[model samples]
Target: MIRAALVWLMLAAPLAAQVTEPDGFRMDHYRDPVPETVAGGATISPEGAYQLWQDGAAFIDVLPHAPKPANLPKGTIWRDKPRHSIPGALWLPNVGYGALAEVTADYFRRGLTNATDADPSRPVVFFCLNDCWMSWNAAKRAADWGYSAVYWFPEGTDGWTFMDYPTEQVRPMAPQPSQ
Candidate 1:
C-alpha cells in the first residue's frame, strides 16, 4: 500500500503545479489583446493598425518569406525588397526560423542572437497566417528573450494583401560587401 501511495504522489506532483485556482490564475502577458470591446472582442479593423505599421511602428511579418506567388505593387520598390520591411519592421519567423514544429532551445537562442546583434531601436514584430497562433507564440518567445518592443501583426499577409499593400516575392539575400 505504501508503494502504491508513493507512486500516486509522484503522478500528482506535476499535475499540482499545472492546476490553479480559477480566480488567482491569470496569464495577463500571454493573454489575447483585450480587444477593442467596442469593436467586438477578437476582431480589430486593420486600417488603423496598418497605418500604424506604415508610420514606423515596428512590426514583424510572420512568414520567414513573403507570401508565395507574390502579388505586389509594381515598380523599383517592388523588386529588391527592403530588409526593414514596412519602413522600420524586422522580419522574423514565429516558428523558430526552421522547418515546421522546429522550435527548440537552439532555435530560440539563434533568434535572440540575431535580434540582439541588430539595431536595438529596430521594432520587432512577429506574424503568421491570418488569425494564426504562431505569431502570438513567437511574439511571446521574443518577449521572453527581453525584446521590449515586440508586437504581433495578427492581420498577417492576408490583411496586407487585401489592403493593396506591396509585398516582395521573397526577400533577397543581403549582398556581401565586395572584398
Candidate 2:
C-alpha cells in the first residue's frame, strides 16, 4: 500500500501539470489522460461508484462502439467488439463526443430521461474507460442538462475490473445512430 501511494505521488504531479480542465468539451483525442476534477459534478472512485450502484443510482456508459468500415470488401466478415460494463448501466454510444448532432443530442437527453425513469433528481454516474475524456465530457453535459446529481467516474470500466467488480454485457439504451 505504501509503495503504491509513493508511485502514484510520483506520477501524479507531472500528469497533473499536463491536463487542464477544458473550457468546453474535449474536441479530440478521446483517449487520453483526464483532469482530476470536473466542474458542476462530483468525481468518484470505483468503491464510491459501487456503493452508489448498490443504492440504484443511474449509471451511464458512454463508450462509443466501433462500426465496421464501409470500405470493407462486400464479403469480408466483420464482427463487432463486445462491451461489458457495470451491471444495469445504460450504454449510450457516441454521446460522449465533444460535439453532438441534433439526433445524438436528442438521444442523450431522452436516454437520460428514460434511464432515470424521468426522475430529474436521480443521481447519475457517467463513465467510459480509464484515462478517457469521454466520461468527463458526458458528466459535464449531464450537469449542464440540469441533472441534479451527477457523478463522473474517471477510471471507468478499467477501474471497475481492476477491483474485480462484477460486470455484465450491456447494450445501447436503444439503437444509436452512428455518430
Candidate 3:
C-alpha cells in the first residue's frame, strides 16, 4: 500500500500543474503551461516555424511592452527594454491580452493586414515566449477572424535562439491615431 500510494502521488504532481486549454481566451496567469493543442490552428515547433519563415510566412510577436511608469520622478529617463525576435518579424505588443481595447483590436487588425498585405489566405505565425498563453490566444483570435493559415509557436524566441537561429531587434508597430 505504501509503494502504491507513493506512485500515485508522483503521478498526480504533474497533473496538478498541467493547465488545460479553455473554450475562450486565458483570462489570467499569462505565464503558465499552455495546452498542447490550439483549437483552430496548428502548434508549430521551432524547426517548422523556421521553414515557414523561409517560405514567407509572417511572424508576429505578442509579448507585452512595459509602459513607462508615470510615477517616475522628474529627470528620470525611461528606456524601453530591447526585444530581439526572429528576423523580419513584427512585434505587436499587448494585443495578446485576454481582452482587448477597441484601439488595441484595431491595431491588431491593422497589423495583420499589414503583415499579410490584406490577404487573409497568407500564412501568419504568432508567438511570445515559452509556455506563454498570449501566443495561443492570438492564434485562436486569428483563426476566429477567418485567417486560413494560422500557426502558433509555443516555444517562441527562447526556443528559436536555443537552436542558434539568428535574431534581430524589433520594435512594436505604432498604430495611427485614427485606428
Candidate 4:
C-alpha cells in the first residue's frame, strides 16, 4: 500500500504544475486574446503575417528573449537558425514572460520597455515554437498595452527552417562552457 501510494504521488506531482486557465482568465495568465485594431477580436493568420514580412513591414521576432529553453526540442531541427528571416525582422527573445499566467504588470512593462527602448514606434511581431502559446500570449499582452500594430507569426522558426530560407547562427553573448 505504501509503495503504491508513493508511485501515485510521484505521477501526480508533475501534473500539478501543468494546470492552466483558458485565455484571458487573468491579466497574467491569458492565452490568445483579441487584437486591439478590430472593434471585435481579430485573428492574425500565418499567411497574412508572411505577407507582412515579405512586404518589409516593421516587425521583430520575439524568440531570443525567451528566458528558458525553446519549446522546440533539440534534434527535432536539423539546423536551428532560420535559413532566412522575414526580410526585415528583428530578433527579440521572450525574456521571461513565456505564458499568460507568468505575466505580471512588471513583465508587460518590461517587454514594452525593452521593445520601445529599441524602436519606440516599430510594430513588433512575436513568435516561438509553432502553435505554442508563448508568442501568442506575448503579442496579446503587447496589444493590450496599446501597441498599435502587434503581429504574431504562428508558424514560428520551424516554418522558416522548413522553407529552406536563409538563416545565420548567432553565437550566444556568453561564452559556452567546455563540455
Models 1 onward score TM values of 0.45, 0.87, 0.88, 0.48
Q: Identify the leading candidate in terms of TM-score.
A: 3
* TM-score of predicted structure 1: 0.45
Candidate 4: tens digits of C-alpha lDDT, residues 35-149: 3232112335566666666665554454543234467686664454543345445454543254433434454455455545645445566665565555666666666667766
The prediction achieving the highest lDDT against the true structure is: 3
Clash count for each candidate, listed in order shown: 3, 0, 0, 18
* Model 1 C-alpha lDDT versus the unseen true structure: 0.48
Q: What residue pairs clash in candidate 2, if any at all?
A: none
Model 1 Cα lDDT, one tens digit per residue, 1-179: 99999999999976743322122212333223322111111223457557656666545554544433456555525433344334333445434332234444444445545544655444555555565555555655565555665655666666666877766543423322357
- Candidate 2 lDDT over 89-148, as tens digits, reads 999999999999998899999899988999878999999999888899999998888888
Question: Candidate 2 — worst ten consecutive residues by lDDT sum?
Answer: 170-179
List per-candidate RMSD values in Å. 15.6, 3.7, 4.1, 12.9
lDDT of 2: 0.92
Full ranking by TM-score: 3, 2, 4, 1
Model 4 alpha-carbon drift over 4 Å, by segment: 1-21, 25-46, 64-88, 96-122, 170-179
Whole-model lDDT values for every prediction: 0.48, 0.92, 0.92, 0.52
Local lDDT at 102 for model 4: 42
